[model samples]
Target: MSEKARMTTHKLFLLPDYEKEGEYLTKMHSVGWKLERVSGFSQHFVKCESENVVYKLDYAANNTNYPEYIKMFADYGWEHCGRVMGFDYFRRNADGLSEEEMEIFSDPQSKLDMMKRVILTRMTPLLIIFFMGILPNMYMIVVNSMNWDRSTLLFLAVLYLGVFALYVSIFIYCIRGFRKLKKKYTE
Candidate 1:
């Protein structure tokens, strides 16, 4: 028998919504790549015949009972594919399943709760770093620019400004995603 083709891809950064990330993996599965493992930003997939597979992601960074947590999903038909960066990846055949049946979250409130968990666990630290570290350093760099060469000052300023821009973009993206979810479900 021929060996299955395998490949690796870098996700680069976490998506604002886990559903979007899951949808991306589901799309890949529909095109014949089955997710096998995940390591940091790298996802490994093995080629297979194209089929309808539903992929779902759940963030459970602070889960104390990890096995029980996974067992709960497995009891409901979700096959745990992998976990990376506190995100658990699961998949199952989507044939003859309704959209709600394919979903891992039971209700709109659960989805909102998951988003809150993500915000607390991931975004909070990012906000802290942006406000406490990057902003302060940028201020210091500006106040002490005279001590450094012109080229060095320019490089530091540009670097910090780029990071600042990135942080702002991410914050906006996440807020919009959360608001959309809340409005779509609550309305």
Candidate 2:
């Protein structure tokens, strides 16, 4: 806790992976840095004076009960850090805490429901854009191949194909993340 706060570069994940996010936060806490705030792709960390802090991230939608929801976690000893893209970040001091005591969600069913909310609220719109916008443009580029000259065609092809690849990657990521949560819970 020498300095106030510092910004460090972190690779942003488009799809939410709650467990992985917690792992990263736990790692940061282990090294003396704690999560201060999050905005878009940037995560702010501060030099913390405590160790063994466990973080929990959950897909809490932009709803009226958000404040009360946060209050509940606060009641449970989890500090309301901040929200990023409708996801709530919470952390509690795990001094002498066991593995089970570090958790926020008590059961797999609750965790599964949280992941479902993420898919319905966040990933669904991106999936729609991928299918509606990217797919149609891709189809046009492939079908009307001869109409465009080599140079113009090449540029559009590259641009649209890049978009297509990005969309596919995001879609796959969302699906895989959702399924992994589902499998972990149902088993």
Candidate 3:
């Protein structure tokens, strides 16, 4: 027996824009690299024949009834590919299915609700840390910087600013993404 060729790629998807991640995975499958699983930021794939498929990501951080959840998706013809960091990966053959039929979400509101859940469960804690932990530390650093040497002050300034910039960027991305999704679904 021969082992199929496999590859792993690293990807970072912001919490609010997992739809893009799903699209990426679908594109990979279309190019003959089918996703086998995900671990942290690494996506593992095995070589396979090219096929038309639709991949969807759903956020459910704390689903208690694990068995039933997979069963429900199975009943709807979706294969549960894997789960990574609370995101459930599902896919189905899209060869003859309409866009409507390919959707894992049944209604616009359900999509909105999933976005909310992703925000609440995944993004919220990071935000809380930014507000409560990072902000306070930043304040203290600024206050104490007045007594520091020039070089030490410069390093701290750059480091803290970089961290602050990252948090701000994430916040902005979430706001813009949520607004776009809400408008798309609601309209």
Candidate 4:
């Protein structure tokens, strides 16, 4: 067979969605195979033939500059392969796995784990804002109350609100940026 026909290495670039990773692994397990997690750059690996298939998990890229990364990969001779859906339905259909195997792979535990990780990642910034901004504002309020100056208190309150609004706007903008990135990559 030609080299392309005999190609055994399959590189999977995983978007930073941990839930999706867990789901992919759970489905793969149903087929009597398991994925090994890797660090940095690539996230997982699967032994295919003479080489190990490298799977990169980057849930961060799901909503980041993934398109540019994909382009860079293409430039480096990596083919634009198919993507795995949240579950293994597409894989099962393509690989012709039996229904029994699919059921086994559809493990709830993996899905739950994936969900937890995704939620944690998404919430991290919000948690940071709450601690850094809201908590400080609370402290300021306490301090202002002790001083008992109405005008100073009002000014401080207004200033804090303005800062809070700015912080919220920035957060929203970042979220939009991620969504845009996702759209670009999917296209």
> Pick by TM-score: which candidate is best?
3
Provide the lowest-lDDT 10-residue window in model 1.
Answer: 12-21
Candidate 2 per-residue lDDT over residues 27-88, each given as its tens digit: 88888888888777777888866588888887767678777998888898889887888888
Better of 2 and 3 by lDDT: 3
Clash count of each predicted structure: 0, 0, 0, 9
Return the candidate ranking by TM-score, descending: 3, 1, 2, 4
Query: On residues 1-187, what C-alpha lDDT tens digit does candidate 4 reach at each position?
Result: 5432211224442334433444654454454443443333343435332322222232221535657755655564333333443221112222444444333214545434444444466546566977787868768697768776888888878887787787677666655644554454445
lDDT tens digits, residue span 57-99, model 1: 9887788999999999999899999987788899999999988
For residue 43, what is the lDDT in candidate 3?
90
TM values, all candidates:
0.90, 0.88, 0.92, 0.31
Candidate number that wins on TM-score, 1 or 4: 1
Q: Give Cα-based local distance difference scores for all models.
A: 0.87, 0.81, 0.89, 0.46
Cα lDDT for residue 159, candidate 4:
80
Q: Which residue pairs clash in candidate 2?
A: none
Name the regions of candidate 2 deviating beyond 4 angstroms: 1-5, 98-100, 142-147
How many Å off is the CA of 4 in candidate 4? 52
Model 3 per-residue lDDT tens digits across residues 88-158: 99999999898788998879989999989888888888889888988898898889987999999889889
Which of 1 and 2 is the better model by TM-score? Answer: 1
Q: lDDT score, residue 110, model 2?
A: 85
Off by over 4 Å in 4: 1-130, 139-147
